[model samples]
Target: MGDVSITVLDGDTLRSLHVSLREDTVSLTGAQVLDLAESEASRSLLGLSLPQHLKSSALRRMNIDGVDDDVDFRRKELSPEEASRKLNEYLSAIADELKDNPLVASNLDGSALRMLLEDEDDFAMIAENLFTDLDTEDKGMISKREIRNAVVNMGVEMGVPPLEEFPLINDILKKHGAEEEGELGQSQFAELLQPILQEVADALAKNHFAVIHNIKIVNGSELKKVLANEKKLNDVIAKIKQEKDNGKSGHKSTEIIKDFLEKNGKELGLPPSEANEAVILLYDAVFADIDSGKGASEEEDEFRKLVTEILEKFAEQLEANPIYCDLDG
Candidate 1:
């Protein structure tokens, strides 16, 4: 069998992967391709094994090269502000399109508008995912029927209907699906109509990341206080500083502290739910204090500096073993 060669071009980052079913060549199963797609280095290769037409369509949406289509995907990574700008343009276009729909006209106020205006990065991410999901035909365009179907699907996912009467709501859904000459092209709907934020937020509330944030917020604060007061914890931090000051090599201070706390956090009054929170807070506090010089006693300045160094090493380990770290600062 001929090998499948997938080339991913993300700006200057180019990667090519080849797989074959032939015994003479290196081969990967479908399951392996799916697994590899979840990794960041290979993530852009996700659509490569799809049907040729579908792969072309997906790459066009991402603006990747090699497509015969006119779409360009050579853009640089967006800054948060640039992402916000792109999302806002989409929101404005969608609001214009649905201006005549009573549901959109009357309901596009308050938090819905705030998400579009303020949380643009998050809104844009949701919009991108939604656009991909709604474009069922893989043509990159969303038909009027697709838009209506998306709304209905979101309503079902969110467990709420626009109207109390089920049949009436179905009628409205069908009516909306039949509008404006029956279809909206890729550029028209995919780019313009996907940034509607209220719907995005409602649908995303059940997402795992949001749930993790809520869990961390509730538990991380208590962990911070407990760790701040733990005497043994401070002792290890002080030792880390002393060794660095003496130019001594080979110290595993962060690991010592993390392992100690992982085993003894409950004895220090932290609840079981806050064990991982304690580990995260310890690293966060070290970096935060070092950066801000906050609350460092004259005698403890060296301690803070050493703690910063120790935490820097600890952060590398944390990235490698990020078991419970799901919240953002």
Candidate 2:
């Protein structure tokens, strides 16, 4: 939502600073400046909120000039101007490190999950959904171990982190005998799930988790760039023509174009064809409106027009309904 703020220990008291290299005035020591930079960089680049361990880990990896190790930086002092300059350098390095390995991160304070637990009807619906999803055999029962899967399925959107990221979840499962081999009816499952969820909520209330998502957002800006550049547009047209010539005989020009776009759309600011149902529908709708009877006999200029029109249509559609795609997948 909003830019995250960092809390720094200012002498005897802790003070919150909305650290911005462009706007904020720096009054902290070199150590405190590093702390602020690490926290701000983690939040900005990684989408982490209150990332206690992640901040420390990121700081260790950062190569700040004149700072060798933890103890050396801890004792170093800096004037306000020097602090700001160093903070910028440290954040720039962090940006470089994370440029290729982009992540979508969110802060989970457990409020939403706790609220769901508090509401009887909502919790009942959630438990029912989980039970149905877990009971793949349609037996109306699932193993207690599946509870772990249920929590994971709830995921960051529901304020539950992946078990691997938050080891405490495994401990909670063990404490509740959820790790034991046993099947549970829906009611029994809910009965056990409530306490485990309560404990998770309590733990999260104390210390939140910074959930990172391996997702990339496509919103048509890159398509706009491609459309604006004559050279890139010509290159795309040339590629499409090549694809048309090499494609299977008897396939319509529109079909060849659609296939090429689906395979190579990411660079053009389009989501993958299989990104989701919405993207599939978008491709279907765009292609359906075209003249499927148009063949390779069309002139190069006409084909270019068709390709440009198709790309424009896709750009317009994406601008209206931006898609989120799994970068890892």
Candidate 3:
């Protein structure tokens, strides 16, 4: 694909928008075209609050099977008919990705934070609350350095980037004389903090940052894959059976299976057993509803059936109510 200018319809407004890929070179490679497409998509959808992973997933889902990245498009330029077909296929693939992943977006233009700042009563209440939280010693004043903590507490929801992400926060603190070793009363703290927050708000308004939440969606997709693979399913069952045999003899088969799942559920499309109260409740509810009287003394076929039944229950439950867990956790 050479430096081509194409017009694509805006999905939201149904308006035709021009997307031009202009490069210094006469022609682009397969990889270059893909890259341009991704860049254009991101630029056009900048206002959409999409997580980074979803954007990358959309690109990966694009159809580019036979288009070799190393091939020179200038020498093997596609005919107009072929190019049109490929373009339509790529567009369809992109649309499919968006359709599969429902979009829930929130525009972070610092307008909310600005409104709070403009409200004297709200701003004073917020400042007072922050002071009370930071002043753990019940002192009348807090160190100037505590402003950093205040900003951190404001966080992404309040239009403040993490200190580690935007090092400009440190510069803002320094400029506001927050680094100096001095204690400020609640009123003074608010006065000094106002300018710092104002600067942050201004910076965000000029150049917004996209926040990638550390959350993963689990919807039994991986469980379905494991169930589909005979080898993997056999391996899991064998492992569980071995563990059951090795475990204390008096334990119910359900308990043994629950233990195995708690320890090794990630591969089967389940979240960490102790990730949060909701996951813990999910585990409790599932196990509680199943037969707890099943013991190791059951026949081998019966044991396999029990395991399959348990997994199917999990799959059904997850499909209905997908669990969201911290990706890092």
| Total clashing pairs for each candidate | 1, 0, 0
Model 1 scores a C-alpha lDDT of: 0.38
Alpha-carbon error at 239 in model 1, in Å? 19
Better of 2 and 3 by TM-score: 3
- After superposition on all C-alphas, the RMSD of every candidate to the true structure, in Å, is 21.6, 8.7, 8.3
Q: Which stretches of candidate 1 lie over 4 Å from their true place?
A: 1-111, 114-133, 148-175, 178-183, 187-215, 218-254, 259-284, 287-329
Residue pairs with colliding backbones in model 2 are: none
After the best TM-score superposition of candidate 2, give how far the Cα of residue 20 lies from its true spot, in angstroms. 7.4
lDDT for each residue of candidate 2 in 168-270, tens digit (9 for 90 to 100): 8889989999879989999999999989988988887788777656666576767888998999999998998887777455677787888889999877778
21-85, model 3: which lDDT tens digit per residue? Answer: 43334554444454455554555554444444554554456522333522443235554444444
What is the C-alpha local distance difference test score of candidate 2?
0.72
Cα lDDT tens digits for candidate 1, 1-99? 111121222212212322222334344332233233223222232212222333333333334337333222223333444433333332232222222
TM-score of candidate 1 relative to the true fold: 0.27
Relative to the true structure, candidate 2 reaches a TM of 0.60
**Model 1, residue pairs in steric clash:** 63-73
